[model samples]
Target chain A: MIKHLAAASLLLTTACLAIGPAAAADPGFTDTEILIGDVEPLTGPPALLGVAASIGHKIAIAEANAAGGINGRKIKYVLEDDGYVTARTIQGVKKVIDVDKVFAMLGISGSGQSIAVMPVLEKSGIPTVIDVAPVKFLWEPARKNVFVVGQSYEEGIVHLVNFLADKNPGRKWGLITQDDDYGITVRDGFDTVVKAKKLNVVYSGNYKKGQQDFSSDMLQLKDAGAEVFLAGGIIGENIAMMKELEKLGIKPVTGIFWPGRIEPVLKLMGPAGDGIYAVDYVEPFAGAAGKAFLEKAKPLVSEAEFKGINRYTMTGYAAAKVLIAAIERCGKQPTWACTISELEKTKNVETGVMAPISFGPGVRFSNQKLQIMQADTATLSFKPVD
Target chain B: MQYLVQLLISGLAIGAIYGLIAMGFAVIYKSTGLVNFAQGEMTMITAYIAWTISTTVSGNVFVVAAGAILAAVLLGLIIERLVMRPMLGEPVFATVMVTIGLAVILRSAINFIWDAYPHGLDIGIGRGIVHLGSIGVRTGQIAVIVTLLLLLTAIWAFFRYSKVGVAMRAVAADDRTALLMGISATRVHALAWAASSVIAGIGGVFFALSYDLSPAMFQLGLKAFPATILGGLDAVLGSGLGGLLIGITENLAGGYLGSGMKEVAGFAMIIVVLMVRPFGIFGERDIERV
Candidate 1:
């Protein structure tokens, strides 16, 4: 009789051990909540940008929960601040994956920050939507579970430069970009377009990340007699470049990248920002479609958060919406695998802010379309250039 | 020649900023005889203070500058009394560590308070170009250079001629002997910090006005280190000129070479200069009796 009891207990222990692995296989999901995570800078040079991106994620999550969530499960977003440090990003990604046991990660940081954590995210089988840093390194040789949103910097630059070159014939182009992978992409795009157009490439300068001074560079550009220049830096650098250009009394056709189209850039640049051209996949928050989106967001977010909303905010929202759609497709049991598959199958999904997002098998990059806009500092907003 | 002229003016403008920050480093080092690694963060914190003042109190440059400078002096006094004074007799390494700790705390506090948001110091010398012959200079640039010159003269006069300045110098040279001679080492130390912070406050405002004010302004203070080292660390008066030289070198290297050269030129100059002159260009070498 004792032997029979022992055998029965052993059988029960084996069964429980097998079930534990199965249960935790798709963790971070409960009867009413689906936990999602994001890694943001939140402090450092890109702190404001990170804060703005997080606000976008918060608004999207809030909007979803307001509508009763996805298949009766609300999103519980966990934002980990990496402070724009790659090592911190890796640590935070590991913590969110291993410790928090998140279902997925949405909305990453700058190019370097996002790229550093790709291996860990892919290995952990996290369904990640590369929202902010839409660079090629994130999407190229695309990982199975990663979905990239928006046009890559290279793509946007290619489109903008080609268009600009055609618009302004025989113009000498001076390009200034940061000396990083992102900047390399800008140079690559510039080189490709310039070669094709047989454009006069007068001067190209590379600056360290977080460099504020551009006086010397402006002088070089002026000396080179560049009639049209691309200030291919972030918001602060663009503003500084404009100021330096003004200081030297060297006025040229100023062009900035998409990231420089935020309200802060408009505010800081003031009159200097006027007439500068920029390109982006997301429509300006001051536009008709963006107005309707803001009208919805105004009720959901605080006035300050509402005020903080910009191009990045829209991209963050669109990325979240895409992830939500995939989760919705997964219904009650929204496992990471199911969400990844659902995202891969997403085609022509429109969020009314960014370009139509499309993905399929062997294709993970979404939103290739870029829109050109001009800064109207007089109104402190962006308008689509004709 | 035209391009060189433009570069020279811009370089001098930036140099003036570095010089002011370097003067703060030199003041503390000269009087207290300890390198304040926290000088950078001090400048950053004071820049934020200046921004707050400008935004809230007045947009007038003088009003903003005065408010920031006064606040900086108070900060210096409070820090010296509460932190530095307590470590008066401690090992030099320990006190320096405390300063390092102070820097971390100040930086974190600034981050917590400001979140690294960029604030345009609209209370600035106008960005209008002031053309001199064929060379165009911004009014802001002229203001920075002029501020540097005026402060340099005032600081030079005070250290050279004032009774308190000589006392501070005696204390720095030999605190034990100076105390015996009725010079209060504590008083001199406190004064050194206040005066250093005054320079920091001015530097912070101009640095912000030249660009924008944010936590990142701390980097300017660090960059000024090369200037202090290139000048005599104890030669407070010479440090500002050292800053200008470094700035000019960086700008010229950037102009002739590339943007990457700009950052390297200053540090490289420091290395070359130190190999030749261990006490910097103007630093006094101490003789020890065997």
Candidate 2:
């Protein structure tokens, strides 16, 4: 009787072991659907980024599902508004992780907001693709689960400064940035290039986040006789500074960070937006890839949502494509660990949205290239500068 | 010298807008003994309303401004009648809290309706710079200063001579006493809010003309708080002067000291003024009986 009981226990143990791996499968994944979460600024000044990212994800997921999805499982996307607030972002991450139980996170907006939710993401070991924010902290000391898709603000700024220094040698430079991580990151890049080139930085000023007036700062830059102004601000600040420069009639050869590449800025700045140089990692929405994206996106999204598509939309689309690519490589019954490993193996993945992206081993930031573009007021769009 | 003149002109232009916003605060506080924390949000909403009208009607600046002012006045009356009137005789803290709540609600509502994108108000200014000898000034800045002066004068005259204005002053002095004197304190309160909204609407339009219009523009209303406190929360005309002083001080400090000093100068001035005269430069000290 004792021998018989021992055999029965062994059989039960084998059964339990067989069920453990299946139970350990990632949350929000099923035979028919894979749920992905996004935390972004859908209701605040940065809402444009969130909205565009959402559309990108929707378009990519819809396209994937139409193409028979990943191993025949459709993608379900969930987005929560963080309003560009860090505290709210943490809450959003929790909701997406604990409540929504998403398979992965994509398009987390803003440097601070993304950084704020890193601890929770690490604890969950969820695969995250940061599409909008370009802070280095997201990928540096790289985690096994975190992957960044775009060039860092530091890299973008450095590239632009190098281009400007080459184009207009020995120009007196001024900088007006927001007093935050985003501004500081750009400033760090600008500082690196300035020190390397031994360039003259005539004026450097910073304004509080969400500040409306730039008259005093502009006047100070004007007084300092800066010939080339480096605008290290987001969309609103960039436009405001340009308007102030126009008001003061100090039209320096201006170089703005990536946020200035948006369409609304050109529209709002009108003729004042002319001649301002901006750097971007993605092809402008008017590019061949962007035109293709618009054509594909038109039928899938509402007219309003389509109109909202911009460079950020491309970011979202590219991020989703990468995520989908990783899942496709995970084979049947893909687990979180398998998906993350597949992501690490990504190489030169083409999305027809931005530049080609690749990630592997210790390298997490997939795209490190940037292109300089000039705003044309007539078209209210950015054109690549030769 | 050119730098100094440039800073001064810029300061006055910004100060004039601050003064107008401050007056809006002063008027509401004087009549109702409640600080409308939503003053900034009101200004932002009015500007957006004007922007929407401008975009839809494709009208010039005057038509947009008129439509915005009308909308603001209507909004003010509705808020008073619907929100403030219901809170009559509530604790001051409770009433103030309500306004704070109102501020949040109004801000969210604006975001929900218009989204949070910045837009430019043409206002026919078009970033024109006028050269006065060696110093240059923006046409928008000059317009802001001129408009503030005219608005302040008109407001002062209304309070000094108009029957409704004198009734409002009486109601502010003592609500119960004004009621005893057959002055409808309710009506005065509603009227005060309407007048304040009109001022905010005009200030918002000009502010948008100078800067881009965004939901964050409501922050300017909060920045004008020091101005209101400096001029006396109850003194409408004095708030305007307080705005000018604060603007000039901060700009001069920023110009000479540095960029960081600009934000500090305004708050520091408020602290010094409060220490010397708790009621403010033009605010009347209240005598309460236990």
Candidate 3:
């Protein structure tokens, strides 16, 4: 009879554990670790981009934990490599959501990978902060749980066009774009501005994204007599264009989208890279904000990684800060629903590098465009341009 | 007319690369009755090898280039000994699949050696522009065309005159008969693989100099597949000519029609040629025995 009574009590306790604690424990009291999950492509062509972004998140979370933690609860991040494959991203999200049961996800690197994780995140009611997706469409539809930290490529292009008009007047324009939605979005951005400003568009061409040759395209563009150039493509295409341009001795003022760092271009172009300009949303270990973030972040991220982190890192760091703040607003004992609700109420939260984020009703893009910085050859550094 | 001439010149240069790759395919197909799916990867690897040697050796461009080709030939012999030789009696499908697997392994290995960043070699081919009054061509493009001519001639002479080339042809004609005639079919097959890789190496060097090098360089094989089909898989000279035709047509289509139509034009050309001349413009027609 005594043995039967002990078994019944044990069964009741197991049931209670499965059902979650009856009432919200005091804030930070219930769980051993506050688990967060992230997916980044640590392998594949864009691995460097994902690696830097992941490291940025780790640094920020580590710093938060070191400061007695957010709301006195330690933050633990579980990361997986998606390798930029959509199928793998789905598996990564499922593993994080079902197996790890992360409190939330902080930063996921690619647009396609983020989209791959969307269904799982929505079903699980997991709050997610995107580090790299810039398309407004990604956040628009009132997903209720998703927030984007990067500015749309369209907005970045508009900013670049306006800057170009002011800096170099009467330069006949041309665009070399990839044949894809992202490239089309950039082209549309440039076209809208060209019409508004009455800028002359001498030539335009589109090549596939992963193409290795641009000789024919470059020759045609040169023949069309285009002066100022706008290139909307990934890093590889841009490198091909730059090489061809150097070979042809054509020096057009170029506006290229996010093409990683300056080293490979410099290595390939040698001194020909003089006066060539690129715009980035994050400063490269430059200015007070970047330096401060680096100093604080350096210890947490691997030492091998500190020097190479770019704009993507800043986005990751910013996402982590916002996520922690949202967690804090949930008070003691945070539920996914309540944490998301508190996150929606945030306004103008400063993240040091990006523009302030405000996520109220109907505004999901966290930052409203950060300052575009120009690469300064004199210092071999980046500084905010006027 | 001026625009047309310019397009023609540009197309021929692009086609020359296709022709070289198609020729490599043709040579291997004739000898072994197998399509080397790794042909593009072969070019990519050889180019990268040349790139490394050129960068590290600090010698004249010609010397470095010759050394790179020699290295590629040696590497080709090694690849045959290791990968292709063991699969001599395998089914056609199995052999093709093996080549596909080899291609993937080669591509990944190259990626490991050099990260996916695009690189271009500076081979001191002058950057001067040569203008035909109304039309312009860069020295780089001219060099590509010249190299193609020289390669085609060398291969032509090699097959026509060399005793080993005759044996290779005999093996390609009928492996059983060639074996009965006391020629080692395996030796011919090894020589074919070695020769194809050499072509691949030269093609890679010029390709890097003309365009740039990346993991995507492997896509050049996809572009050349059409050339092989259009030229007749067994026709070496046709490979070169078809590459030029495709290149020129692709350019004209891109320039005159639209970029979206360029791929369509290539496919359309192939379809039309296949419908009219099923054996290809130069390929030998197959006759089945009753």
Candidate 4:
């Protein structure tokens, strides 16, 4: 009777072992190759930014492959350009999943674009590394697979408020923000900081998304004694404001958010962009570390592509680093289940750009600690604040 | 008082550009009895063309502006021949729809060719700030304002004294009567389109230099819509004055009341004007049509 029972248990164990790996295996992963996917904007209005992010991820993927591959298994990356459209982004991600059969996705930029692909991503059971789009609650529920890689908008704004408090205290403040969800979020973020710190925000004005003239608004802010002006808008609005302000001869101390893109501002503002303050998630091609990373990444990309890297590039690089590390931890033949488990175990993963990433059960997004900088129009360069 | 001075300087600069564009709208409507909704898009496209020429060919601003004007004139004539002429006797709605389509086509074509990035162009003008007591103005701002005044005078003179301009007005008043009087209505319409396009070209260059050129710049049409209604759709002088009034009122409301108050104030003023003076400040009551 004892011999019979032992033989029965051994049969059940064999059945369970056969069913486990078969069920957990995602489509593209095999014994020797792991396929990854990405959706970035390569063309359209924001193409400059999109191209930079795509190149950054491509470099990281190439580097990971060159370094003996991930756990001796090669990593293949397939990218589709979404052109900053939410609908196109959804279709691109679907193609990557259905056609390319990638194991995971990384470096999906744009706020509305990500929201477009969320259902497909969640349904596929493929983990996504958030390289950009710092809207809170994307990873708040600890969805077991999704992870964010940038500082929250609130934290970025908090750093700005903290800096302002230190530089010029007891001064009336004003805000000039665009009218949109992102802009509203920025205003709210700054308002929270101001109210919490008991600072005065004298005047606040909201402009439509594509407004050109700000002379009237600026004049009002000046009359209201707004010594410090905080602009929460895109590069287009910022350029318009600068032009109008110059015409009105009212150059109050100003601070603008990173606008998630830089080339637009640099190209438009040119010489008029002197003495502007901005906060960023990562250093924008500054310092020794930044140059070193560029040197390593330069040969991997085209010369024309080098000018494209900005804050998003760093986020892409960080996402790639985290993905590579997770793939490496999943052993030679990584399955979706094993890779996701490894990703969840990420601790102190070093991204060449941005801050060190350490994500676990409760901490799936990076801390919002940021550095502020001043733009030098003469050099078209950014310098770290003392 | 200082605030008022600042508002005046800024308002006049913006108002000048609007006035020029509004005149273009009135010119086309007065001759053809159809509103060219694509006026703003034409301005944007021509400005971008001028910008491309200025940047790539390193051409003079006058050369670029003149080229843009000639191009717009050709475009306007072609639009009349292809789109407007076919539906000459058709419902006004059809013509309106054609103009809308033209606007969309022009905007999309610009996006496809140039992409969506906004480019800053100098257009051979300086942004040198000039202080007039408490008021401050840039060189480009002053130039734009002066250019508007010059354009208005030239247009008035042409319509008042020039034989061709008088013939065009006769055609606008009664096409059948003008045809009987040995005036070719088609030729008159073509001339009106060409002149309107030239005015649009000027407005385009000034607007682009004053504000960064972008795809969204076409939305300036919405603001101009109120200006057109307030100025009288077919009255050129009224449209120009209406644009100035709207610009100044919107600026003052935005400055003193709140940012949100600007659009509100614009509509309110338009409503009051339409109710009190349905023909507008300078518009003829006999020409009033819903």
Give every collision pair in model 4.
Answer: none
What tens digits encode model 4's per-residue C-alpha lDDT throughout A1-386? Answer: 99999999999889888987775556877667888899887664466566667777888988888887787778788988787788889999999999998988896858768766777888888878877777776776666677788887777777887787678888889898778778878888898888888878888898876667888887777778887778777777788777666666667777888663364575566665677788887766656667778888888777756656666777788888888888778776667777778777887777768767877766667664588888777766666785
Model 1 compared with the native: what TM-score? 0.94
Give the local distance difference test score of model 2: 0.86
Candidate 4: regions farther than 4 A off: A1-52, A58-103, A107-109, A260-272, A292-309, A324-335, B74-105, B108-111, B163-194, B277-290
Distance from true position, residue A54, model 4, in Å? 3.9
lDDT of 3 by residue, A1-386 (tens): 99999999999988878765435321223454688889887665666577668877887888888886767788888998777788888898888877887788876757767766778777777888887666766687768888777777777788888778778788888887877777788898898899888898888888876666566677667777888888676766676676666655687887766644444544554444545555656655668887888787777777666754666778788888888889888866787777788788878888887668888886677656645555555555556765
Model 1: per-residue Cα lDDT at residue A105: 85
CA displacement after TM-score superposition, residue B186 of candidate 1 (Å): 2.9
**Per-residue lDDT of candidate 1, residues A1-386 (tens digit):** 99999999999888889887656668787898989899988776676677778887888899899999988988899999887888999999898888998888887888888888899988888898888878888888989999888888888898889778878899998999888887888889989998898999899899987676778888889889999898888767788888787767767887788877776777777677788888888887678987988888888888867766777888888888888889899877777888999999998998888768899997889856778888888878888885
- 10 residues in a row with least lDDT, candidate 3 chain A: A21-30
lDDT per residue for candidate 4 within B106-206, as digits (tens), equals 87676567755677667667456778875777777788888888887887888899999899789878899999999999898888888887787777778
Q: How high a TM-score does candidate 2 get?
A: 0.96
Candidate closest to the true structure, highest DockQ: 2
Ranking by lDDT: 2, 1, 4, 3
C-alpha TM-scores of all predictions: 0.94, 0.96, 0.85, 0.85
Q: Per-chain TM-score of chain B, candidate 3? A: 0.96
Model 1 spans with C-alpha error above 4 angstroms? A1-22
The alpha-carbon lDDT assigned to residue A291 of candidate 3 equals: 82
Per-residue error (Å), model 3, residue A364:
3.0
What class would a CAPRI assessor give candidate 1's docking? medium
Instruction: Give candidate 2 regions above 4 Å deviation.
Output: A1-10, B123-127
The window of 10 residues in a row where model 3 chain B has the poorest summed lDDT is B126-135
Clashes of each: 0, 0, 1, 0
